[model samples]
Target: MKEKIIIIGAGVSGLVAAINLEKAGFNSVILDQSDRVGGRVKTDYREGYQFDHGFQVLLTQYPAAKKYLNYNLLDLVEFDPGSCIFYHQKKYYIGDPSRKLSLLFPTLLAKIGNVADKLKILKLSKALKKKSFDDIFLAPETTTLVYLKEKGFSDEVIKKFFKPFFTGIFLESELTTSSRKFEFVYKMFAEGSAAIPKKGIQAIPNQLAAQLKNTELEFNTSVEHIKANELVLTNGKTLAFDYCIIAAEAWPIIANLKNQESAWKSVENLYFKVKEKVIKKPLIGLIADEAALVNNIHYQPIKKSDNYLLSVSVIKQHNLSKDELINRVEEDLAIYCDIKVDSFVKYFKIKKALPVMHTVNYMMPPSETQLKDRIFLAGDQLSNGSLNAAMLNGESAARAVIAKIKNGFINVN
Candidate 1:
């Protein structure tokens, strides 16, 4: 008989786990608290405008991501990180991509200040992934700034590079997240292509979800509890299973973590539609070292609609009123692209920001978790919090469970 498995959280991780379980010849039931799958990978289309709630880009080189993301069907829009506009003091300054600070400040070049500072970045890149959170928690995650400072990067360079780049990620403008996350992201940015999806970020999770037609998906259902080999439902029913896998976010994990302290992080997203007269091509912007400012802007061009879509991500609280958020970001767009943004038709905000991955606890534990047996923990957070991570981790967790089941089910060779 096929072993019965119960999976929780119909998000990206949950679906991946369910699909992998089916591949291993196990029948599993996937349960989620929300009405849909995709978890943080949400897209809100308002008046033909598209907005991705969390996680916008994926690198083809990401070890785990390359394994699951459909390479045959999904195409990535390459990023021109070589051309980044830095918005500081309400002005947009173009910075050089080859670690040259002189492009931002020529005067510093003559003082041996900029010339010498450039070498520091070149040096750090040489030694990025020597450690990968195997068993070390040396420093407390303050912000990305302190990590940069400790690495010998000057404040000026931090503002021009680290500020807009890293801050936009964690929603903490100052980079107060853990250095481990900081180090890993920097390496990815510097080395990987900042490719957005050709269609949109939703293509990844959406395509992944579509492939799960063979598996049973229970949407809008919540798991109340599990006890004595039975899965309890919010509707007061129970599901009996041979094994259960949890692919929910940290909130659900911590809730069932029992005695352990629950872990959480917060992210914010602001999206808008630009005037027709705005920039023609889509461009991404990274904010300077400013906390109240947005870390980056991802704009999309849709000629069919006569409007352009734009999303502003600010980890920290942004100082923009309803109208102000739209107007200010539009203003910043003008500075970065040299085209006025007031030409667009309309805009809206989807505040479903969340802890995509945060300081301190963004550290992923083993998929098996601290449990004795039977129960397995898996999710995007279980790996490194990406569409690929979720899928790969889910497969691995399912494999681990199936391996144990095979030993008991199969005849000796």
Candidate 2:
């Protein structure tokens, strides 16, 4: 008989785990507390607009994503290669001239950084391109801020460009995330486009979930406690399993698990419907002001519709009320776009947007994935905070389980 595996959390990790297990001739059951899939990567449609749970983009070059996902089916809409930096009461356009030749003159003239700084960007990209994924993550670790300074990036560029840009990505104002993560993300951006599915970000997970033929997904089913070879549900029911995988954030469920990081980064995304396009191009806008409450903005045009959907992200949580926050965001948008924005639609304050990891790895070893005799753990927290990491760890855990089953190391009862 095939081993009865129970995987917790129907997020990308859990879904991928089940997919891989099924390929290896073992079927698994997935349990999730939420009503749907895509734990943090969900999307909501409101009044003819699609708003992702948070401002998110899928880097098309993610190795694991490329391996598993069918991008053509996603109907992705790509963002322009660079950013429109709002600095000192002016908008400066900067882009990778290598990718788009038209951006060459604009990037050179943009005052966000010096000519040498721009050249250094190309050099950095070239250097990172030669470094393999293993090399990037295994290199000595340090804060991204320190790494940039060591690379001789000027303060002007770091402040007006890298700081605001990566702050939005990392969800941390300070560039204190590991340099390894920065390199990995930078490599991804340099290699491919940052895009979202025409439907929404949730489509990525929906695609993965749809591929499961043998796995059973049980939603709104919470696992209250994980025990030895069994699970206790919140409704006072228990079920036995030959193997269990904690594909969710393990720190919360497994009490004895060590080295699990629970600290999470937060972000607030405020959406608005505008009559005119706030940004002509599909490029991310960064607020370079040190004290600006609005960290970044993107205006996504709704297909076959007259109105455009504007998404403004604030990396920090403030004491301001919803009205106050909206007012401040409107003020910022007015200055950035030179047009008034008052059509406030919704605000998404996500407290656990991304896991905070000081140290990161490309993948975890099989031996490390096994928490106990018959239990395992998998998530982005096990490696780095990215969709790529989540999928990588999930497959890693699934392979570990497959190896054990093939070796007959663990008895199936």
Task: Say which candidate scores most in TM-score.
Answer: 2
TM-score of 2: 0.96
TM-scores for every candidate against the unseen true structure: 0.79, 0.96
Per-residue lDDT tens digits for candidate 2, residues 1-413, read: 47899999899988999999999889999999999988889998766688898899999999999988999999999998899888877888888889988778889999987889999999999898788998998899999999999999999999999999999999998899999999999999999999999989999999999999999999989988777888988878898999988898776566565465588999999988777764577789999988788899988746436567788999976899989999988987787656466489889999888988879999776667888888988888889889998998888888888888888553221
Q: How far is candidate 2 from the true structure (C-alpha RMSD, Å)?
A: 2.4
Instruction: State in Å the error of residue 170, model 1.
Output: 2.0
- The ten-residue window of minimal lDDT in model 1 covers 104-113
lDDT of each: 0.60, 0.87
Q: Model 1: per-residue lDDT, tens digit, 126-201?
A: 4553544332234465556777787777777776766666665655565666676666665665556667666667
**RMSD of each candidate?**
5.0, 2.4
Estimate the lDDT of model 1. Answer: 0.60
Model 2 ranges with Cα > 4 A deviation: 258-261, 409-413
